[model samples]
Target: MNSEARNQHVGKVTHHELKQTLGTWQLWGIAVGLVISGEYFGWSYGWASAGTLGFVITAVFIAAMYTTFIFSFTELTTSIPHAGGPFAYARHAFGPTGGYLAGAATLVEFVFAPPAIALAIGAYLHVQFPGLEPKHAAMGAYLVFMALNIVGVQIAAAFELCVTLLAIFELLVFMGVVSPGFQWTNFTKGGWSGADTFSMGSFHGMFAAIPFAIWFFLAIEGVAMAAEEAKNPKRSIPIAYVTGILTLVVLAIGVMVFAGAAGDWTKLSNINDPLPQAMKFIVGEHSGWMHMLVWLGLFGLVASFHGIILGYSRQIFALARAGFLPEWLAKVHPRFKTPHRAILAGGVVGIAAIYSDELIQFGGQTLTANIVTMSVFGAIVMYIISMLALFKLRRSDPNMERPFRAPLFPFFPAFALVAAVICLATMAYFNFLVAIVFAIFLALGYVYFLLTRHQRETAPTDALLEE
Candidate 1:
C-alpha cells in the first residue's frame, strides 16, 4: 500500500494519525487568507453601492452566520477524516449522488472565481504602469500562480503566508492614517435624499438591507478545503473558522465606519477605487503612504488566487478519486504529492475566464453576475445537503466513530439547514432571474452525473453484490 493509504487507520481514522504535514505556521497562513475573504468581498460590494452604515451591519450578520456554519462543518470534518472534504462528508452522510453534486458545486466555486481575481490583479498592475496591457497581466498572474501550485503544497503555503501578512499590514497602515479624521456627523448628515430613498436611521432601511448583506457575507467555507492538510483538524478547524470570520468582521466594520465618518459619503460615489480614495481624502496630501497601501492591498488579490488554487486542486482531486471527474485529473505528482494535473486544468479555465471577460462587455447583468450568484447557489445547496447528512448519518450510522460532535446534535444541523434556506429565499427575492440562472447550472450538473454513471468503476464488493 502507498504510504498515505497505510498511514490511514485500518478501518477508521484515529486522533493519533493526525500529525502535521507542512507546518502549523504555514497552515495558519492559509487560514488568514480564507478569513480575510470578507475584506475582498467588501470591496466588490463597494461602499458606494451599499452605503457605510448598511455595509457595517451586513458584515456583522455575515460574521455570525459564517461562524456558526464553519463550526458545524468542523464537526463533520473531524468525524470523517478523509481526503475529500465536503464531498467525502456528503457521501458518508447522504450517498454517492449527493457527494457528486456537492463536489461539482464546490469545483465551480474554486474554478469560476479566478477570472474575477485575475481582473482585479490586472487593475492593480494597471495603477503602477498605466500603459500596461490588462489581458497580458491577467494571463501572467494566472500562469505564475498555476505554476506555483504545481510545484507543491509547501511552496504554495509559504507564498500565501507572505502575501497574507503583507495584505494585513497594509490594511492596518491605511486604517491608522485615516482613523483620526472620522466624523460621526457624516453618517447622519445629508443621508438619503431625492433619487436614493434608502434611510440608515429607519427600521425599514435595515430590513431592506438583508438581501445586500447576504451577498456581502458569502464564501466563508473557503477555509474548509484545508481540512486534510491541517494538523489536529478537530481542534484547529473550528478555531480557525471562528477566529478568521471574527477578525474580518471587526476590521471591516472599523474601516467602513471610520472611513465614512472621516469623510463624506457622497465622496465615495465619485471614487472608482474606494479604499485609496477614502484613505487619501482622510489623510490629505500626506496620502503618498496611501499609494503604498494600494499596492500591498493589490498583493492580496495575488494571495487570494493562490489560496483558491490550492483549495480547489484538492476538491478536484477528491472528485476524481470518487469517479466523478476523469482519472487523469486525479493524478498526484510523485515528489510533490499535489494534484498537478488538476492544477493545470484549473489554470486553463481561470485563464479562459479572464480572456472571456476582457473580450466581452461585462455589466451588472452579465457572466460576472451569473458566476458570483451561482457561488451563492452552490453554497446554499451544499449547506442544506451537508446539514441533512449530519442528521441522517447520526441516525443510520449511529455506531460509526466520531472524533468531534456538533453541539446540540439535530438542532444545530436543523438550524444550519433553515438558515441556508432563508438565505436562498433572500437571493430569490432580490433577483429571481439570477436565481433561475443558478438553477440551470445545478440541473446541468445533475444531467452530467446521470450520463456518466453507467461507465463508472465499481469497488470489488459492489461487483460481488451484482454476481
Candidate 2:
C-alpha cells in the first residue's frame, strides 16, 4: 500500500474504541466512587498541619475552588467528550505541548492516587485480620480490582455503583452513631495548633494543609475521563459532574465535622483509620460500631481503589493511543473491549509505589505521604491546565458546541485557576521534596515526548484527531 493508504489504515486501527455503557447514574458512581475513600481517611491529615479550625478554613476554600472548577470543567467534557479528559481539552486548545503536559500531569494524578488508596485499603484490612500484613493485603487488593476492571466496563461500573452506594450509606450510619458523642470542646481543643487566630503560623499551616483539604474532592474530575464511555456524553456528563460534586461536598463536610466533634480531633488527624479511631471514644475499641466500620468501611476504600484503577487505565490508554506512551498500552481486549494492558500497567505502578519506601527511601518520607504529595502535585498541574484550556477554547473555538456553560463564565473559571495556582505553590513550599520529584518526572516525560515528536507528528491524522 502507498503511504497515504497505509496511514489511513493505521488511523482506523489506532482510533479509540472504548465501549459506551455508562448511563448518567453510572457516571455519577464513577465520579463519587473514585474519591469516596477521601471521606474515610486522608482529609484528617490536614489537622496535623492546621488543626481543626485552620483545616476547616482550608477545606472551605478548597471546596469553593472545586465547585467552580467542576462547573467550568463540565463544559469541556460535554463539548469534547473524549477519553483523554483534560488531555483532550488541552490538545484542542493549546496543541501538542499543552496536551503532553496535561496528559503527563493526569498520568501522575491518576496513577499515584491508587497506591495511596491501596495502602488505606491495607490498613482497613489489617484492622480486621490482625495477622494480615498491610503490604500483602494492598498487593492483593490491586490484583483483584485490576482483574475486575479488565473483565468489562459495564461490570466494573455496576460494581462501582453498588459499592459507592454502600459507602455513602456507611458514612451516614457513622454520622448517626457518632452524633451522640459530639463535643464542641473536643472539636476545638488544639484547633489552632498554638498559633493565635489569624497569625502567620496559622496561615502557613493552612497553606500546608491544602493537599489534604483537596483530598475531599480529589479525582472527582475522573468523571470527565469517562466521557467517551458514557451512553450520552453531553447530557450524562454534565449531570454526573454537578451531582457528584454536590454529593461529595455534603459528605466531606458531614464527616469532617462529626468525626472531629466525636473526640479529640488531633488524635485522628494523621492516622490511616480516622473514623474507627474516633468511634473508639463513643463505642469501645471492641464495640459493634467499630467492627462494622472495620468491615463495611473496607467498601469505601475499595470503591475508590477500584474506581481509580479504572480511571488511570483509561488515562494510560488515552495517552498511549495518542502516541504519548507505548502503543501496545492502548490495545483493547478483543472480547472484553477493555484496556487490559493499561490496567495491568497501572497496577504494576501502584504496587511498586506501595513498596517504594522499603525498597528505596527518599528524603525519609513515608510511602503514603510521598505518594499522596506526588498525586496532589499532579492534580494541581492538571487543574491549572484544564482551567486554562477552558479559557483558551472559548477564544479559539468560540463556535464549538457546548452542552453546558459554566454559570459565572470568566470569574468562576478564573477563581478556580487562581485557587489551583495557590494550592500548587503551597504544596511545593510545604512538601518540597515530593514536588521536586514530581517536577523531575514531568520534565523527563516532556523531554521524551519531544524526542518522539516526529513519530507522533508523522502518525495517521485520523487517529490523532479521533480523540
The best candidate in terms of TM-score: 2
lDDT of 2 at 279: 87
Candidates' RMSD to native: 5.3, 1.9
> Worst lDDT window (10 residues) for model 1?
458-467
lDDT of each: 0.64, 0.88
Question: What is candidate 1's lDDT per residue for 1-467, written digit by digit as tens?
Answer: 44554344222212112124545556556766643543544342434444555545554655556556666776777676555667777876667787877877777767766666677678678877889887689888888888898787777888888987887777677678877776787754544331234554533333334444544345556556666667666666666655665666666666566666767666764333566777777666456786677767776677777888887777786676555777567677766667788888888887776666543333354545555555566667777777777778788878766667777666666667777777667667665776776667678878877877743442111111111
Clashing pairs in 2: none
Q: lDDT (0-100) at residue 34 of candidate 1?
A: 45
| Residue clash pairs of candidate 1 | 183-261
Model 1 misplaced stretches (Cα beyond 4 Å): 1-20, 35-37, 40-50, 190-218, 269-272, 358-367, 408-413, 459-467
Q: What is the lDDT of candidate 2?
A: 0.88
Give one digit per residue, the lDDT tens place, for model 2 in 262-321.
Answer: 987778977878898888989889998888887899898889989999989999988887
Clashes of each: 1, 0
